[model samples]
Target: MKKNLLVFFCLISVQIIVSQIRNVDGSLGRIPRRGSDSIPDNEISVKLSGKTKYTDYKIISHKNDTTIIDTTLTIQKEYKFNFLRKDNFELLEFHNQGQTFTNLGYDFTNISPFPDIGFRAKMFNYFHIEDVNYYQVPTPTTEIMYRTGMEQGQVLDALFTTNFSKRFNVALAYKGIRSLGKYRRSLASTGNFRVSFRYETPKGQYTIKGHAANQDFFHQENGGLTPTALEAFINDDPNFNSNRARMDVNLSNAESTLDAKRLYFEHTFKLLSSKDSVTQKDFSNLKLGHSFTRDSKFFRFNQGAPTTGVFGEVITSSGIDDKTAYIAYNNELFLDFNSKYVLGKFRVKTMLSNYRYGYENLQNSTVGITKNKLKGNAVSLGADWNGRIGNFHINASGMLTPGSGRLSGNSFKGEAFYKKDSVFTIKSNVEISNRFPNFNFLLHQSSYDAYNWENNFVQEGTRTLGGSIASKWGDASIALTNISNYTYFDENSKPVQFSGDVNYLKLKVSKEFSVGKFALDNTVMYQKVANGDSVFRVPEIVTRNTLYYTDEWFKGNPLLVQIGTTFKYFTKYKANAYDPLLAEFRLQNETEIGYPTVDVFFNARVRRTRIYFKADNISSFVLKKNYFSAPNYPYRDFVIRFGLVWNWFI
Candidate 1:
């Protein structure tokens, strides 16, 4: 299967290359432009004739922010061209492409006010509703992104969008990956498919948008190397240094899978409009809105045979299979009011939510018979405010559920910002949330005797205040948080909550310097645990630096090239250990693994296509082989790979 997919993609790539060569002077290889007329960077104009500008293609975020399509090549693009298709500065990836990541840092500023199905280790590659994107374009647009995988497979993401009429648009996208890792029982495969649509009435009185998605993730678990195999790996034994498959693993026949599907829609109708043509009317544009969402998820773990030494005794040694499922529905109705007195817009809303999460039937083990499910409904009241005063813009939202139910809690997030041109900007934000622990923490059932549990945990609460500044000099941010009833997995792979308050502080800064055709980009982060370090742990410092040279090559500026190398390092600390059975990370103090890595890259751009070539972890060849992503799990070795991203408009 892996070889077939590789061959298919290679054939398509060759076909596209040939087409580009044949149509360099035609539409296929021509860049989007606004004719030969040049417009000043500070000027804004609308042209009804000639070719369409890149700004005509728009991407709308879940929060209503909009940005135009960008086809430029830069260092930032290099950082984001990965399996996740995003910048992973705060994360450390495992050995394979579709596997999990270890959190180098945490962000508590934006958290949900409701509990979910646990097993966070399996959610790194999963896509939530907020990750989906909508699009609007004057012409049919398509984008294809491909990347080589770790050992035997690759990753591909394709997107297409088009407008049927002046007021209607639709988009379809899919991303799939398969990688047979170098280690035994480490294969990973995943797929994500989504479709989105948007429509508006000709009078601009009604607007509607929605999306549906289906996703699945599957991976084999080996439970890392055994004690003897670990010693040989760290000692740099020449016999097994080049061939990693020869190493012995703890588990040989265990696998885990996660599946999810969602359907969502939101619509708005304007009840009233302005009385005159004035921009600032006393009262104008009253709107009524409704939003609906239904999502379902399932997780399963299977083992043909159990290892008593690794996972403890089991109720039945024949085989083990564990499954958990979750389903939720949310309906929100809101009224929006726009008035000159209020400066901007205000919204009042109420949400009705229903949830069911747990096992399907009762399981009787040596421990006891555990509860099957936690099902209930909740009603929440919410308010949102957005306004601008002089040079400052303020936005805030709050939601509350008064009763003493499992979903009973309150959440609030507010932000204020000031900007003076594009050179200087400052922002401040605050967040507060109180919610119950995940379903697995409250109730769980498994074939293993030690994995079944039932508990009544209290609601966890957290508060945070943060501020950031961005100017021509650089960018900097600082945040401090206080957490109470912090829930986590203990070293024994059991759910536990901290009783005392945990205080944490984080500071980060980034800057770039350029001289001639060379530039250096640096980003550094510092973290400190003021109290309760046992339950909450993080590295003291993490940093990444890149030095690169860029220039236009060839005569007619047919190509643009960038050559660079990046170095990343972090301080050693008590990192967490991963548990495959529950797909969770447990707190541990036994292993402290931290080291520096170097990666070299040569990237170039031609027309609307961007090519990437990278040699990752070159430092591993010269340094000691003591690096580990987690306890007993070694980091990946040196490898070279290449791929490309291309865009087409019709």
Candidate 2:
């Protein structure tokens, strides 16, 4: 069966490549312009992943060119690929976007808003600045957006981009978020800033591109609600009422903070060039480039008193103070080729990196005062290929480290996608990777009982095969994954490595129906685990349904509004518990969590301003109050939130 699957994919890939070549003659090789003039004012080109070459792919807006205030806000369709929902800008949510404290699912990592840490948080997707999008704006462009949540939560974002000349451009972006949760000691705050520049010599022979960024994350840890408090709240105790602040928590005076800084620069000089008849400009055929990056991260956890009981006994003499720092420097040299014959691009690069990671526990006498450190150097080679034929696109990349350092490993990722002009699309992806355990999971020491671990673990290997199909009706996707030597925190909140292999299969489906101005959208996910349910736990079924009415109102249809109520539910299962000290979710068998949650929201747009009002947990009055997002962690209670986003151009 495996051999046949491989053969089938290979044959499909070959067919796609052949078809692309055969249709190349009739292809325009450029995205169609939407305006009457040669250059569309609403058209903007984008290049991601630090690619130096220009492509015809562009993001075009349909709004007319006018003052920023004249622009109208448009509702964004919710993503259907994931089962997560968006809660108010705060912590304690069941698999939600923007909110913290959720299951990792197939991510195979912890949930922390630190960019320097090996773990990835859902919020990181909102702060990632690696992808660069160049705009062809004739004038300066600036956008400012702000959103306010219930309690004291707020989010602000600002962006400015402009070109000094046809060959030089720069962009700056800033995002800030602060959320004071309804529960005590559950505040979360983050700030991210980035500045990037792209420059090209007048002759288009030499180019320089770079970006510098800083990110900071802060959150107060409230080690789950006490069992007594949870029971009282669930039974509708009058003393607690609906106020979460009165609920007793395990930890009342603890905070976690992370700070990170990054600088990346790449410069390329063309070795060969040819004139393009279509654009009347010189394009680089072969280029030599060098890239450099410096990244540093610091994490600190402070507690007013030593943590004890439940998790374990802490043998510490003083208050808890734990710190971890990581610094890495990377340099790479590469050669890039832009093929003129096959209409493809390829690049090969070699990189050298120096990484240093360490930690210090101030209150733990057993670990001493001296810091524990680990440092190493790694050398690796990587290559990437991207091409298009007809309406199909293919991208593939691979990297390997020849056992030169502790981080020695190999990874391969590839994807093929075909689109048939508003009809349907099909995409397939495969990935194989071998990666070392995260530094924190391998060696960590702290004054808290659940915060100390030391182990020499083997590298973890993973393979995933996925495919998706999308059309006007809906979309569906399936993924099959296998993991070997899986490392996770066990039921005891202790780091453990599973020696056996684990397999997972996931399926997602989304469908939409409309009647007049009313619409019903549903997303469902089903997951199956083989041989690892004890370690890897997930709800068997997760579903979200949204029913809403969208329409235009006011004179000249200037105001657009959408009122919707969302219902999310999951099957009962032994959900994993979270470790506040380690910022990781671990397997647990003592408690099972599964509940139905409902939220009502009203969103509107006026000109270039978008506004949102949401009432979460609206059905708490009727549903069982014993609901929990994770074991021992009571989900947020009923709450109302309001926010807005506004864009401006100058």
Candidate 3:
């Protein structure tokens, strides 16, 4: 571990030295001010004061929200500098990178309208249509992010985007990681590649946008520590404290993998044109659009030799291999009308979807062969409305597929927002949906006798209503949700559904205070399961607090520095146990795991580069050895890590 750390730092040092030699105004040195004295930088720009400004570099989302590029240092940025590259306040990660995370809370508002292929644990790093971004930049833009892994590996995410003309733009990105964990027989490697394009006609009458993505995740599973190993870890034996690889694990040669590929495109053409800009609000226009999508995914599990004690009895002790696949295709056509009479833009769409998911052959074990596949077609109709009234903006969408097929269901979601500049913003939303569980819960196949099953279950229904207030004072949100026919895995790793309805409530608040060079940021969440505690569980309270100092480092303010220490804690609960075979968490009532963690970090920004250095789980050294991410899986130990994010324009 020490040698790997030294080599990683040396590579970073070499890059910094090369950059210094290539440019006198280096990132760590004096940053050149934007003025006429500066020479032409990228070929796309003549001068910094020209029409091409920082705001010209745009990032567009699937919902058509546009945000400009921003390079700044803040505590929020520090929290997002991790494996997932997002704020994981509601998640607890395992000891290694590229591994799975335990759920500390649930958010019903983000549920999907349709069921997925299952294996939610492996999908954390997966990229969906909404997760991809389209770029429109004045010049070629590039961003590179690098981070140190657990023992002998690293992670890198790189992106590059450029505009060929004012009407056409293209972007490419790839993220890959390889991590060899400190534990025995635990290794993870994953990769994702994406390319997107956006184009429009000269008259802006026609537009098209699409992307292609390929991703795969592979992880070697050791199940967890053995009984003797668990005892040694809990007792903090000196012999095994520093040498984790010497410990015993449940499975010696077991692995799991997930692979996926997708292709999508959407095009629109305007039928009515109006050149009157002053009367645009009163003018009417009509547009026609079409979209097509195809997706293929599969999950597989392999074991060299089955362990009867760990996974029950298997059909054969020589070896075990299990695989399942899901393939889907969707086509949609829509018409949009923009008029003053309706007070908003209205759209009506019709979609046809086809799916096939299951194994290639039938199971001949004691479970018996029921069905080999679930293949069918679903037709759906939907409508959307978006507009504003006075100082408020409203958006709503509803979709229905009326039939007795597997995909037949209905969903409706609506939101309203009112904002008063920087003073405050108030928002409210409601979502209701009825959908079937994932494919795994319906049908699964495995070499192990206890892992194969097929069942007919009713559609699960959920409704969530929430509101929030965001202002200079703080940000707070509250939500109430009710669920019927909730499906989950039992302690024995079998699919099950709760008979009664479940009700839950969540409250979250965040605030930051600054005084001079010192600042404190805090976030807290409270949750309650009004009913169905036996089926649903979460910590009663979770909180994170940070106290940091910020200041300009040099005379010319070329460097910005922030140093902080964060403390996080959650109440004890019977957290769900992990099942690597299915990549799912099952119900557990034996042990309760919850504890506090402390992390210290020093972050700095120099021009377009941001550097981070952190000491995670610093309190673990002085605390007890009872910290566990799952039943027998221990949490991360004290370790120091460093990484950086850099951006360049050409």
Candidate 4:
């Protein structure tokens, strides 16, 4: 009977798992200042002071040019000037001797034909129509800064200021790049637009964003495995490529402080083909959260909502497979001063939720079907406090959940913050989390076409510790960061072997300097990544640098240039090869693609509105990483975004 009921729900879950895409115009956040037009220098003039002529004014002819002019006028007063070109001596700058000008009082320097560069800059910061172009260095996270804006990678992918009407803030962008002897990239084209707006509907802060993009592309990979290896492989699929109609939309409300009704939804759909053996996955859920307190000091806090976590990948499962769906009701409650909260400045939060999980391989024949109908319940309670004084802040918390059957464990976290000066801040933390096994982890099955085998999901626990130091100097800055984590796998009840963990350390610094009318920025980052298991995706050592220059030397019309590069060195994988049970070794001279390697990269962005150009993988240094024992590949050559961007905001 239990197996029969589980089979029924698994059949119905397929309908909810269908793939869907949503609008993306508002995927990024609000447009910021540090706007492209900001001048690094502190001095500039911006004001309108030209001759005010009145025809047939109450005339007073001062004898010659020697008459001292001392004048003051009201709204209806008039003034006039009449002189011949030859006899008219150029007038010097007119000064507003009394009433101050706009913010940061305008400086009135006595000079001829007011300094052009200094003149426009004075008001540049106050003007409308600000945009950003984003371009950046490639890292594991794939996050690039907008260069033309305050950051990198922002130049070519420009977004504009708020639409004066307040309905939506929108902009247009184009991204492109080049590499090796060949240059290919997907352009933002004309439909690349992002918009965000807010309204007061008596509910909460209302926000909506829309993004539309239609990008064309090329083959994803060019090279192939050796002929002998290819022959031995059973299933060899072609590279994956497609022009997707990608759109993402987000809406939420958090307007009034007195209101606690918030709703958020985000969807990503692809207008693509299942030819690459695509398996559709639908991601959807809703939540309602609120906060309550007594005497303005939060004692008990709770929020309840319907949430979901899913894994949907596109693969040819014989019929229609590769989808895992989780639908659960989640609730969290916390207490700052509990029943004898234990410590002063204490706080606690606990979470309990029930979920129905389902996984199915589309082509279910015999070995294709596996199902588990289960429920997950977790409770987490934590507390924190600090001894505030000179420059020290310390706190800590612990949480635990003993699940049904074989699922149970406890976890904890501790954190601290120390500041010695205005320029420096130090942050540190330690975390340990235990995840109990469920139906999906223990009863799910999928065919591994890439490796010609079968794989199953399992339970695991993770522990992490790390922190960073942020320091600033002038407009330039620096940061030192470090993080390490370890993971343990579970078989039936107890732990078995160490799965994998990663550690990374980095030092990053950057500065902006101006040469003539051009602005330039230089930044460099050095990072080291280490993996305990043979699951190698992170790099041993990677260095990245970016240079940016802008041509706003003259007002309005400007030119921008950004260049970036990355260097990496990898260590051979090494395990206790001598120990038979725990054997692992770094690939050597005659190994596969996962062997130790070196790579370099170069990317650039240059633009001026509707017209722009760029290059990615300028050097074509194929920096790649190996992910698993079957010798999986993590490769990056270059991806470029370029073309025309047409947008106007009113």
Candidate 5:
């Protein structure tokens, strides 16, 4: 099989090269130039720019962007998609995607505190207010994407954009997801909307970019299953066989919801410009800009029947209603300098910012209800630089808050990378920061007994050094980190600050091999604690493997298909427990969980449309039912799901 696959790969490579050579002398290889009166009827020339991270907004013929159609069709294409098969890009991580509620394998070195209203479970699905993109579409363009799950789960995403003139454009996008789990009290839903606009003067001396976004996330907290019920279900007790809803849960009538709204605008004017010889457009060498941002968040938790046994003793009524709200405002002024001074283009930005955050929380007590308000202000100076030297690129940025405020601290980050043609690349990064604890961790009050806390915790300081190498074969990376004054929830479910320093090391590697039409890909990660395993526990090893076959079907190769299976396993370890009232995973020594899981999938793409069909946990019938993603929380059962995504340009 291996020899056959290798020979097939070689043949395909040769065929592709020959096809490229043949097309080089034909009009098929030429990109249609702008301002052409006669454009290809089937071709669409697009310049996409908005969210710069996902896309660079470069002008390109639609036929050349294969990733938009190819990558989306495969489940094994990206590591993030394997963990959480959700449309919101939220990795189904055991830990690390957000905060450390549980001792899951999260890289604390990369965690940062953001001002939030305290609801966390669903925040992973919320679209970031700062990452909204502005679009420039020549004609009205619309894209609709829909997906269906095994249960009553569905996801719908829509986007529309149009240009009123060549100089101005506007876009609107909305995404909604609802997944009703087979387990009790495990329903999740999210709704997100964004509107953005971009405008530039005909002379290209002035420009404006702005966007507004709103997001809401709702979740039902089951507090996991009971130990007795789990054991019975694993033992194939006749009462609960194949009946998930019959299992006993810790909580049944609790819900957590969060809503956020944000508005941002930035305007820039060129102070100096030079004519670009190649593009024949004015290039701004020095630019002045001002930006304003306002963000508001609200969180609410309701329990129809508060169970004191599951969530500590409650000081409020049997039925509880708790709410928290926060608002933040930021103003910034910056100067940007961009030019080709030496070997490559150099860019630098220096900025001054003023920030304000205020919050109000409704606390319940035996006597009645109380409202608490807290506010803080900070002023910071920041700067960033990016430049290239030969085939290497470097970027560095830092910010310092000198005045007296809750956010008075300094952060520094730097990275450098070198690419050797297209064969391989090496990169290194370093980060040092002093950050305050989250507002909720500092002061929070709720109706549940274990959900209230108030303490003055010092700043947490972290330093990390990491490096990675990527080549045609695979990628490898390592990181070393040290943290001081770590804050976390203790075994007692109370917030505590660890004064001692903790050191950690993590290493990861991934590789892919292809033989003919068969491909095998594997990834493994190892984490070691030099000092603090009691506080920060993680599995020693985690591994994932995928084996697949790929081929083209039908005439003209219009259909590309891949059939594959994925296996993921992690070493058993003492995973942390979760606290529903706090919407947090806390330290626990009661149960340790780690298990192996398997999934099979078929993916195909036809032109601009992609289809996916998957059966997750296919080995559940043969494997032990003790498989748990977190303590007491059984992983999903064997289920089939199908979905499709389509992009249209009109």
Candidate 6:
């Protein structure tokens, strides 16, 4: 125990010294001019200095120039390790990206202020920097857009678990699915099964697990139409697309673990089949290979002051047949301490890691964020302080990473809440931080997305900070926000000159109540963008109410009905002509748009049988939009949906 504590402090001290001795300066990024002229830095990529690591890299070029630079930055490093030796860490692991690399690129057009279910969650709005692409032609003014941003998908899943003894249990599961939804070329059709058995012992548990899945992506062209910016080009160009690279994988893992009152040890092994045959060329954006990894860890007590642990994981990738090029091994070491009293009011936990990124596909975007621009590797060290007083809780953390030629910046965020009464409450938060570009924008020089008809490219917008507040009294609630507020630089070395700052503010209020047996809820909101524009967009105001009544006379059954509609307003400019590099000063009046949608449902039960019928978008609203959602197409009109759900298993 004493030796463990001594090592913990030693590692912390060494980390502090290394952080101080680091040599670096703020990195300079690039922002292209709005119009046709290209203003690239001496180095193709100005944002990443020559000394950054553990991030994506890129060639910040323009429609007219494509130059290579000395360094690209690795701004963000996150390692999610499993606490147990047999645990392997991965989020939504082993996802099948379909038949192409479309899932490998930037997908920004989805945030067109349109009510999209899939695009909202990937949280695409977090990054918006420069634009890069090939212009087939321009676009023309349209009277209306139709059936915009449509997607389809289907999946099947099953599971089973059993325990033969007090110390042993076996579990198995299988999944099958197919989908042409979400991002471009972002489709999937896959099948996979896994089985694991664990045994508990006095000292620890012994376990073995294995699994494999295969996925194929569809390469469909002329599948849709796209919209453009130029009036001349809009009429002359056809929005056609092709698939680039194909991706597939076979994966399996094994691990052993030991757990005791004072010590813990674990070891893990993982293998992935990454080599894919390139029979077709959608574009020369991606190359496939094989990746193998091993991870291990240990945790011990140090005189009982606190728990201390050390961990490491390494990975290697190789080309199957052609050794023209491959990936090298990368590793990281983590040091941890807990329950350590710091500053009298806080308990501190610190960690540090060094690792390299695996390979990824790139994109071909001419006017938006992409993954091709992000690529690099580096060491990461962070500290988390926990503090509490009465009903108040506070925390603070920061990181300084060096990648390419620049020192990637850090961020600080915190939140608080209070309750004044049983029915009233108040909450607020002050968060300031920088968000790096998406994975595709910084790494992998190959195609990432393809199904949607977009080529892959790099994204280079970083540095974002903001805050928000909310309060509730009686049956009413109000909120104020400045979610995206900051001055940003592009991948170039120059500052972006906008008509104004990239700042926005919002105000909202809502009330919840019920009339007799019907419960009702309501809300409304308004926002003002920094560009002197007031737009009503996204997750808009709506009211929903459910009427309930007991029909005990009908075999102890109940009758319930739900009705709801959402109202929202916003506007997007569809210029007779537009420059992908610049935004023309030609503005349009606010469009008082109305999306009155409704949902109705019925539920009934009789003994062991229960039934449900639901209807959505009863108004049959078709999609409408002016942005280049796919390639040169816009969503138009309203649509409707109806379905029945049955519960057969509990």
Candidates' lDDT values, in order? Answer: 0.86, 0.67, 0.86, 0.27, 0.67, 0.26
Badly placed stretches (over 4 Å) of model 4 are: 1-322, 335-347, 360-371, 384-397, 404-408, 420-422, 437-440, 447-461, 473-496, 499-537, 547-557, 563-612, 621-640, 643-650
Report the lDDT tens digits of candidate 2 across residue range 539-635. Answer: 7888888898999987656678989888888888887676767667777777877788898888887755667777878888788777787776677
Instruction: Give every collision pair in model 5.
Output: 5-515, 5-516, 6-516, 48-57, 101-585
Q: Give the Cα RMSD of candidate 3.
A: 4.5
Model 5: how far is 418 from its true place, Å?
0.9
330-377, model 3: which lDDT tens digit per residue? Answer: 999999988755778999999999899998987446678588898889
| Per-residue lDDT of model 1, residues 365-428, tens digit only | 5687557888888999999999998889999999998787788899999999999989889999
Residues 387-496, candidate 5: write the lDDT tens digits.
79788898777777776556678888888999999899999999998877767777677777567666678888889999999999799999998989877778877888
- Write down the RMSD of candidate 5 (Cα, Å): 9.4
Candidate 6 residues 340-429, lDDT tens each?
123212212222322232223322243243432222344444444545554555555554444442124344545455554454445554
Off by over 4 Å in 1: 1-50, 280-284
lDDT of 6: 0.26
Relative to the unseen true structure, what is the Cα RMSD of model 4?
25.1
For residue 617, model 3's alpha carbon misses the true position, in angstroms, by 0.4
Which TM-score value belongs to model 3?
0.93
TM-score of each: 0.94, 0.83, 0.93, 0.42, 0.84, 0.42
| Candidate 6 deviant stretches above 4 angstroms | 1-375, 402-407, 419-425, 442-500, 508-510, 531-553, 558-594, 603-612, 621-650
Q: In model 2, which range of ten residues has the least summed lDDT? A: 57-66
> Which regions of candidate 5 deviate over 4 angstroms?
1-104, 107-115, 275-282, 342-371
